[model samples]
Target: MRLKGKVALVAGAGTGIGAATARRFVAEGASVVLTGRRPGPLAEVAADLGEAALAVPADMADTAQAREAVRAGVERFGSLDVVIANAGGHGGNAVADTDDEDWRLSIESNLTTCFVTCREALPALVESKGAIVVVSSIAGLTAGPAVAGYVTTKHALVGLTRSIARDYGPRGVRVNCLCPGWVRTPMADEQMDELVERDGITRDEAYALVTKDVPLRRPATAEEIAAICLFLASPESAIMTGSVIVADGGATAVDLPTLAFA
Candidate 1:
């Protein structure tokens, strides 16, 4: 077990990558504290992980709630050794179409949550010389169509990762950011459903259309993303910090000008 005696706080552990990471962490012998806005999903995941997991329902974007989640984790586990800041959401249209509400929501979910989680967990992490894996999106490095708020907040996350790593490195906390292109999570299924409705296509076809030019020609699975998180959180990545690791199935490697030739 790579994380045999570690304790991890998974900020958005209710579903998708967060849930997968929680399960993986437990498998690696880590005690995980699960937090999210949804109580039901958090409880379900905690139940599945048995005693190795604790469920704490909280809106991580809120400072008070975020602090409480961290406190609860440390109270139960005695120490916090890792953090998976995976709480985020998709929102907004193009800049011209995005309203204040949409922009605010996107910032709160995608940016504030990570910031608050890390802020609250920093002391514990420093104490344990722990690592943090910030779950960003490929959108952080490159823009996608008509998602101004998502693009902006994701880009901001990269900067946040670097800043935290730089500031905390001396304190023995390693921080890294993960940018996945498209993962087949419930959130992404929602986006695919939109394409299905607009193009009269099946959900599978919708996903295919989006990833047709990607070298892998398919979206990633949550479990696949979780594996990367595991590495970042474990001793395997002890020497790494302030790194932006892209796991996009080669989507960002292609030149749009050369796609037509393919």
Candidate 2:
């Protein structure tokens, strides 16, 4: 029980990495307050965790809602020891193809949500000398094809993580960023569906095609990313802060030129 007697507020805890992280934290003896835009899934996850989880459905991008979520967690658990800012969505299309609405939604979904949620959770975290894990994307460090909005917002999250770490380090709050590549989540399934439709290939084949150049030759599972979040949130990484962790199956390690040879 690495997190025994701890309390965690996990934004976007309804599905994918967030849900897996919530489950992992609970298994490690941490109570979690789960918040997300979807009420049904959020409630389901919370219910599954029994008394250890509280479901709060709200958009983290909304300042009032974000603050309320933090307040609710602290009130329910008596203290907040960790935060997982895992709320984000993909922004489709290239720069020229992306309309203003798409760009704005991407910023709100991927960046504003984390910014607002973390900002609200800072006071509680400072009191507990807790940690904040910002769930960025591999796109934060490198670009993906035709996802300019996603790439931009994700990259901005890295800067956000560093800035928060620097500003709050003296206050005893550790902030770190997690960048995962091609995680096998419901969101990724949509991308696979696109490929399947376009190429007349199976979903598994699409995933394989996408990860062909990756050293692991496979996409990461949500549980795998959740394990990394557990490390960052637990005392295991006590001395770590302002660090950007890449869990991309070695996708970023390969040189594009060398991939041709491989």
RMSD in angstroms, all models? Answer: 0.8, 0.8
For 138-183, candidate 1 gives per-residue lDDT tens digits of 9999888899999999999999999999999999999999999989
Expressed as tens digits, the lDDT of each residue in 48-157 for candidate 2 is 99999999899999999999998998899899999999999868799999999999999999999999999999988999999999999999999888999999999999
Off-target runs (Cα >4 Å) in candidate 2 are none
Residue 182 lDDT (model 2): 94
**Ten consecutive residues with minimal summed lDDT in candidate 1?**
87-96
lDDT of 2 at 165: 95
Deviation of model 1 at 170, angstroms: 0.7
The runs of at least 3 residues in candidate 1 whose Cα sits more than 4 Å from the true structure, single-residue gaps closed, are: none
| TM-score for each predicted model, relative to the true structure | 0.98, 0.98
